[model samples]
Target: MTPEQVMNIAYQGMRVTLLLGGPLLITALATGLLVSLFQAATQINEMTLSFIPKILAVFAVLVLTGPWLLKLITNYTIELFSNIPAMIT
Candidate 1:
């Protein structure tokens, strides 16, 4: 494969990875921020306080977006596999 083809594949892989992970990461970040704010307001300095909320938020996002995420990855895999023969020669 040419350098350009390799780069394209790598770029696509990264894009897909980001797309798949972005939601969970963002959800965690938002949940953490909200929990921190709540802790500050209530004077609760427990580090573990944020953990459960972040986990629950991320889990909720994963559950809500699971089907779309699955379809996205499946489509990308199918496309990549379909292009393998072309990439080989």
Candidate 2:
């Protein structure tokens, strides 16, 4: 493949990866921040306090977005595979 094609492929891969991972990561970050704020307000300094909520939030986000994420990745993979023969020639 040409340099431009290679770049396109890499960019698409990154996009897919980000799409798949961004939500749960963002949720975890938000959960951690909120937990920190709560702890500060209540004067309860518990280091492990954020873990369960973050895990639950990420799990919920994953479950909610799972189908959409799968669809996105499946479509990208299908498109890539469909073009492979053309790309080879």
Specify the highest-TM-score model's number: 1
Off by over 4 Å in 2: none
Error of 2 at 23 (Å): 1.0
What digit string (tens of lDDT, one per residue) describes model 1 on residues 1-89? 89999999999999999999999999999999999999989999999999999989999999999999999999999999999999999
**TM-score of each prediction:** 0.95, 0.92
Question: Which residue pairs in model 2 clash with each other?
Answer: none
Q: Which regions of candidate 1 fall more than 4 Å away from where they truly are?
A: none
Compared with the true structure, what per-residue lDDT tens digits does model 2 show for residues 1-89? 78888899999999999999899899999999999999999999889999999999999999999999999999999999998997887
Residue 12, candidate 1: Cα error in Å is 0.7
Q: TM-score of predicted model 1? A: 0.95
lDDT of 1: 0.95
* Candidate 2 backbone clash number: 0
